[model samples]
Target: MSFYSDDASADELETLGWYHYDLSRHTAEALLLSNGTNGSYLLRNSNEGAGFFALSVRAKDSVKHFHVTRKGNGYVFGFNEFPTLQHFVNHFANQPLLGSDAGTLMVLKSPYPWRVEEPSIYESVRVHTAIQTGRTENDLMPSAPSLGTKEGYLVKQGAIVKNWKQRWFTLNRYELKYFKEKACEEPIRTLDLRACSAVQFDYSQDRVNCFCLVFPDRTFYLCAKTGVEADEWIKILRWKLPAVTLSVSSHR
Candidate 1:
């Protein structure tokens, strides 16, 4: 369940060489920025949600994540839509993609090739595809262990500034914690999951994949990199709610 469930389809995509089935947003950014030149690009499963793909390209000194939205059986990146990924690549190869502000032009010069011979490709693809498909490893096969904890990067809104900053978040059995960075020794804050009344998606926010953690004192807003990631986090947190509530009842 971690990758495309259809073996034939996945094998076909693998042959493209530019389709990286297992790359995460941050990992993609790191690889493209550190190893690739400007215009170096690759395609991967979008964190946004099911049936979505992302275009990660080295734009200027940094990498930009663009969701290639599905449109009426076709796919779109910018202004134009293509019938297939092959056509999309062919069209963009000659035409330069306009920068966000229309200031610079980015050409698809090189493709960050896929490593077919890598030993980890199978596992990575499986996990990633499962995420997109909204199924855990356990769901795919009973022998697979259930996920007890979830950790990833999410943008959190500050209480005072109301501005968003990406933080490393961790959710466990008893509490949820966020750190300023992934390697930080201490957490910025921790919320007892027992106090969390509910976790729900907040579509009111002017962003995609926004969710709210409802606590008695206040509500915390968080934005995940992709809709699928947000949904998974919400699922795990909600799953913990019943146990935490039972613990409270036992104490009473």
Candidate 2:
């Protein structure tokens, strides 16, 4: 018998939307309520094996647009004990960016569910864990054919400094490979999509089209010459790892 012998069948399964869980519009409205400052909000239960976290950068931490997660919803600023837009407003009320006056709230751009995989665990393409003992699940494993190659500039990390180099990025069935140049014999950097659980865009200030590809072992900060290219990559990447549907009820 299979460990998940009682796995949900197609008929038994619920049809989840891009935001996931097919949550009620009311829940979504309540959950994503922001303080109306820089329009930052938290994504609760982003994906399997993860908890509530920020979809955008928190103005308080100044962490940029990278996804930030925590174990509990205790007295955290955005993730208040009583989760509400009011709580977020109250917490950051005094910030220079925010004030007593209600500011404009920015809505989440992508409706697809977001991915935030747990540390040290790659997404298993196979159902049986016993069969995947030695092999790591770094591959993207698209259901159909891959989207193929793209041209962009990726930021290469050095021992101390970071360098921006032009590279050719390829999306294969299992991984995202980047070559130093179009004709490089081998890839200079490889990101296992199965291990990469989350991705964010416009995270840094250096470039307008900057994006972040996050994995357990490392993070790739790639910059595209144009915003169109950055969004183009995000479209295909999110197809595999969508956005999240959080439950702000835990705010209590």
Candidate 3:
């Protein structure tokens, strides 16, 4: 690899320019690179280790994701092991064969330029202000450990682009974990209730069903699928950090 990062090894496989889909220009959370005309792409995620790569190809009408890992300056994709990146690159180097890749062929070759921000959940969700007297919620609420789970899409800050992207969220106990897709076993990132600076309900008034998780370093702008879900998540977060204020929407 060509200097993936400090953690990456120089002796490993060939490098591909991974195009990031995020709006942020800082971090490299998602990397995708394609020939533009070809549907195939070389992918990498900063959230994942440097050892892994996702090779996506378009076959017929369906797109496929193939898991590959770096091995001794070579690549092991799916079940086949290539001794060098050149061999793997050669396997899919044919122009006709590359055109079939689904991931990039359309996006790169489309007539219309792709727009990242459209009218979506980020626009639909509204944040409310808290009605608490002080910075603390009363002790009468249930604890974070008892809050259980909530399923929704959360607006997450991008690692590279510094923009926000919607991620599938699961609120379990004192933890909030977000994933690239629903039902994924591994989370892209997890937030600790114990480490949070404060949990504010509806801290931003622009969005409905919106809640904010405050931390010393950063803040999470999250919105539940519904107001009830947002309230429940805030209620649970308050229990974990008792001093955190409870926010109630004026509409509710």
Candidate 4:
């Protein structure tokens, strides 16, 4: 069964305007959230397995704008306000240009070996994991025994896809393939959604949607939905997590 089967009811497909892909070590989860208002999509990868990366796209004056972020380390890349290509070049000198086609451009870092490409307006910005250290055994499997639902989360596993000494830990062999497969999914073809904010509040009906999760080192807000009722949904999510946390934690 699909991971979203049980929580399908909780998800309002119509409200999910654009497509967002969450790729971890084990599985890739996609969601259509809000419209393309906030951004085209938000992409995340798992740090435990390897790490996470995200892309946000927005439209400006008929041209699509892109923003890319790496979750844990917080590396951000996007177009600058410079008017000419030379301006972009002067700033990021060490990076090598990957490709430029159909009004889109691609670049890569020869050192970290990262790939940055823009495929389209609504579908702009793609980031591939780089081999920081050397190669290692890498594999992608279900995070847990069972699939996860929107209501239930899953833990995925990544190990050596194949056995080899030199190519074992090299992220280029397996990790890149995994990320591309997850990122290459067809982006939602609409333009009416936005990203849910990390923090939000609603004044109507005397209720507020404030949700926060405290990891050992950091805190995250999992609430905030897309569109007009986003604030309200944030409140609902805030109230829900405490109970949900206990339930999920106990099981873990």
TM-scores of the candidates are 0.42, 0.36, 0.35, 0.16
Candidate 1 TM-score versus the reference: 0.42
Worst 10 residues of 3 by lDDT: 23-32
lDDT against the true structure, per candidate, is 0.75, 0.46, 0.54, 0.28
Candidate number achieving the greatest TM-score relative to the actual structure: 1
Clashing pairs in 1: 1-130, 2-126, 2-127, 2-129, 2-130, 3-126, 3-129, 47-226, 48-227
Off by over 4 Å in 1: 1-120, 124-147, 243-252
List, residue by residue over 38-113, the lDDT tens digit for candidate 1: 8998888887675688888888797877778655445687777888656766776685655766465677788888
User: Tens-digit lDDT track for model 4 on 1-252?
Assistant: 112332442143212222233433122112212222322223333242332233332222122223433322223455434343234334445543422235544343211111224455684322222233453423212111011111111111222332211111111111111111223444221111111112244233222332333334433332223333344433333323333343555687
Q: What would the per-residue lDDT of candidate 3 be over residues 1-252, giving only the tens digit for each residue?
A: 243553444433323334232223122112122222235343443234666665544333444455667777677865678887678656555432233233343322221122233545554333323333443444334342444555567666565666667889876666778999887889998888766766666645476677787787877777666777677777666656533333332234
Best by lDDT: 1
Error of 3 at 9 (Å): 91
How many angstroms is residue 166 displaced in model 4 relative to the true structure, after the best TM-score fit?
Answer: 83
Better of 2 and 3 by lDDT: 3
Instruction: Report RMSD for candidate 3.
Output: 20.0
Kindly list the per-residue Cα lDDT of model 2 for residues 90-190, writing each as its tens digit. 44434323221234323333223333344696774411112234544444332322433344455544324676666777776547788878788799767
User: Candidate 4's error at 85, in angstroms?
Assistant: 27
**TM-score rank, highest first?**
1, 2, 3, 4
